[model samples]
Target chain A: MSEPQILIIRSVSFQQLDQNLPKLQEAFPGARIALLTHAHGVRQAEKYRAIHRVLAYPFKEGFHYRRRAADMKREQFDAVVIPVTNLSGTGFFNVLLFSLTIPSKRRFVCNMVSDIWEVSASRIIWMGVRHLLFQAVSSILSLLLGIFAVLFLPFGLKRLSKNK
Target chain B: MSAPLVSIVMLCWNRIEDVRESLNRIREQHYPHIETIVVDNGSTDGTVEMIQSEFPGVRLIRMYKNMGIEAYNIGFANARGEYTVIIDDDSFPAPNAIRRMVDKFEADERLGVVAFDVRNFYSYDDIKKEAETTDTVTNAPAANDYFMSFNGAGAGVRTSVLRQIGGYPEEFFLYNNELDSAFRIWDAGYKIQSFPDVVAYHKYSPKNRTSWRAPFYYTRNAFWTAWKNYPADMALRITIQLIYSCLYYSMEQRTTVYLKAMWSAFRDRGRLKGKRKPVERTIAEQLRVPWNVNFTFYR
Candidate 1:
């Protein structure tokens, strides 16, 4: 139980962190736990003194991911934990990115309803597919709406000018 | 040790010439500890090569595709400075703008954002005309430290403070992202104010953009902001107010664009639900709820 260090790559909101921190702390009472969360989580991280370190990790952009990965390599960790309940596309990317970026012996993705399980290659592939599918659908919807907006724009502008 | 470095971050789309001119303006600034970082969102107009060849000292992060307003997050990640000045491609800050904004932040530790007096560079008449026509609500002019939202084009933010509140709402995609981020900043116990003396001139072009998309984003994001930042009751009230305004514009202009905006907002209600984090009453009061009803920005 007396592990040296642990990292939690949090891609979730501050609220989720507030809910899950105690459980995490209880599970790893001996290890020094560090958190990688968004900038907004910094103030919130203040209350949880159990967590040894907090780094404001930008979870959205890939370029930042690379930068953070480089900065994170300075310290070695025994384990990395990811909460899966509030995971989004960016969150998934962060998990994949950090997994590659940081070297660790054990990696776990946890959820409230289930037990902690190690992330596998197939699981990452599945999440990636889901993320891509969602993105493709979103882009298609935007394109349709954009074309619709443009089609009706000429008449709208013309009428507005007439009214003015 | 030395003075805190300021990273002037310009989010450029395809305007290569404007980007070059804006860099020249940055070079003209009297400030000493400054670095220029341009986040070009997938521009095919030779913007990458131009910046690499000409502005060798400038740090450039090029995306393969246009990622909209969220592209600035890349610049924020790479920015090595105490303060990050957000700039638009066509917006030009005065020589002393950076010095003044940094000084303001130095004076007030709680100041999260400092918005510049963004005057339309075209003409006074054009400003007046914009005021009359646009449905967007511009910030009412104030004497000093007026509680208002940040203007993405010419606002200086403490880099540390920005990370605390998370960066700009990448979900906003395009317009109104500044206000969305500002609300979060306010909720984080930071002050966002207008520094009237610090000025930036915005070209506010009419031809370079597709004017049709402006109304759509304005309507949708205004409603989205109301929902995401307000309590349930106030959120509902503001949502209704926005719908009414959109309908009013739709009826007046005889265009479906406003309706499309309303529809888009309504359709995205579930997405809005996920992002909602109601601010404290104090912060919510500063939001100026009713003002966002017909809120329009000069594009």
Candidate 2:
């Protein structure tokens, strides 16, 4: 009704944010907007100089994230925007925040493919796929690291014993 | 004494039309001391605006994003009513539904939650046929002392008890959340009943819509619920059956979401130890007692 408080979550990259920012601003002209960019994109977002405030996602930083959430719970936003074109690792964090944060009335999942700002069910499906893919890849990597540590543990222990 | 205020908590997302219809139905109810709280899960279809402009009396809590079941926690925090009735956006209750549920609560102070007889709005003919068959062939129990869960769309929870157990578990982002709450209620020595006469109409639209995340949450939350509430032996057995069924469903649907869901559940198993408060073995057995075949929507 009045000036809407818009929160845009674009975690893909500064390039992606740059590409989408113009249209988003154009879509809601008088709205007071705040930006939550991925840590990697914070530098780019800070330089944009358009949004009222720019904040970096705490990501795996547990304590800071809780503080952020507590601070956010104090304020009410009119709309929350998720600009998703393709899935990236950072995009998953955006999705997690989307699941964690509570917005007022409007949630727009802006998909570049369809050039639409409406909530797309397909986008949810894609997010799940991307999330699992990340999980599978990370799990494999951890397993490999575990095997590497086991293979070298005996030699390192023997060397320590000899030195003693 | 004046009638206690009943707070109707509706968790809504982007189904603007359905939510409007549901709110209208609530307004049509005969209940006098009632308040409606709409927790909008970041709906982009002007749902908040519509509610503000049309139903000015309704309290609206807006979430910038969709927090799924966690929206209930947000609504519960602001709820000042003695009794809290949670209904889904796509569902609406019968005119007398609220009064009947409250009557049950009044009849028994120990009653914690009343699970309404939720019927499919679109399947009236089939439900009627099934009801007629059951009525003639069987003498089924009108109310179950131990309910598996309360339908989030059509259940009334005692506000004081809700606050005691710390509201709905926000960990359950979407699915099987009610079971978690139901178990805690039972553990707190409160009774949960399925009132057959108290009815609400659920459209059950998600069954037709394909969302891997829906099944994913169901599979994941099923195991999570068991781990958090059931005793060691019962939890193990139920989790095993759930995993097997999930595997079967995944194979049948040709989707890997179930496998992923299981992996996610097990990966997050570390948090269970601190949250676990296993119910009594006898109580767990009573809760699992299968009464008869009943059809639940796939969603």
Candidate 3:
């Protein structure tokens, strides 16, 4: 396969940015590497030699965040790498979203110990369907719980008042 | 007078090496009058045995099953120190960190928690390097502003305040327990602050770290924390916003963890019934992320 024209690395902490960036460069030779990270990490990310560009994800601004995602999609990255600690990739919802959004054919997830896997589009779709179903079911149950909470509100308030 | 007794409470689940390292660091603290407590969340590994044999002085609370963050409650109950330092198995304070944290608490009567600057490292060597190079005394101004919550990895809590708030919300099980406790602390008229000079190192090990559990627990506990602490109108508003956020993230991340967490939260709503003693509206407003900017994005 031909080398990617541009590559993006998305992470929450960007903890292994320094170590992972060079290895990624060797794998995707000549690819322009960009760092996509939380805004707080922008200054630290900028200091790295391997990162050709830095894109800070605005944590609080929904509209601006959407605009930033759209801008990234326009860049049309050839590959996206998400470094995760484990197979479940639990705290990486934002990273997963970015990888899917940027229109990258080669989406890779790696762990700190260097286990990397390519996530296929079909697999992504399957995961979405499965989890979305779970979410739907959970939402209904949660609504019921909310009703229960409302019912019990009086007692809770009484307890609070007693403590006061 | 001797330094007021500081209790170091750490939770371990099968990570024996990390726990051992943390305990050794605790033993090396520059501050005198410190007690260490280890709550083993039913480790199949030799964690319980090791703590018993190697660190007999440590107050070890052994459990038969992993109770997650709820296990900390047992440790807190047994804590004899005036201040309790809560940390994970893979985290520990700098030698002088406990001393500095105590100073902060003594300086401000309203201060309930003094958060440590938790530095994460992938390797033990790196942690050692950090310890060697870190400045124990600094003239640099620390951030004096009050924060909403403290990092669970490495933060100190006033034992009395912790007890007053009834420890952590046992219903939380794991994630977001810090925030739940923080809310109660704030409502009790105490402040939480982070000091850069007080440092701790987290191993940040990738091993045995579950992927779906964090998202699930975080999502579920977010609801509980809001419902249990926030004012009704504010809670409802935050819940609606959270639902939208979760829905968006679920579709985007292609994981049902968030939805499942929500469902579980709903299923367990009975636990929170009558548990709602909302914090003041002002406290809720100050602590909450503005709804408009709460949406997170990655470029």
lDDT of 2 by residue, B1-299 (tens): 88888999999999899989999989888778998999999999999999999999999999999998888998988889989998999988878778777777888899898877665565432323233323232222132233455678788899889898888878878867777888888888897776655667787532334456555776777777777777656665565555554544443344677678878986776545456777777667666422100101121
Residue pair clashes in candidate 3: A60-B293, A90-B211, A138-B263, A142-B266
Give the number of the best model, judged by TM-score: 3
Error of 1 at B88 (Å): 0.6
TM-scores of the candidates are 0.59, 0.59, 0.70
* Candidate 2 lDDT over residue span A85-111, tens digit each: 332222233353453454445667554
Docking class for candidate 2 = incorrect
- Give the TM-score between model 2's chain B and the true chain B: 0.87
Give the range where candidate 1 chain A is weakest over 10 consecutive residues by summed lDDT.
A155-164
Candidates by DockQ, descending order: 3, 2, 1
RMSD of each: 23.2, 21.2, 6.6
- State, as a TM-score between 0 and 1, how close model 2 is to the true structure: 0.59
Report the number of clashing residue pairs per model: 8, 11, 4
Segments of candidate 1 deviating more than 4 angstroms? A1-164, B122-141, B144-146, B289-299
Model 1 in CAPRI terms: which quality? incorrect
Candidate 1 chain B lDDT trough over 10 residues, lowest sum: B124-133
Fnat per candidate: 0.00, 0.00, 0.04
Best model number under lDDT: 3
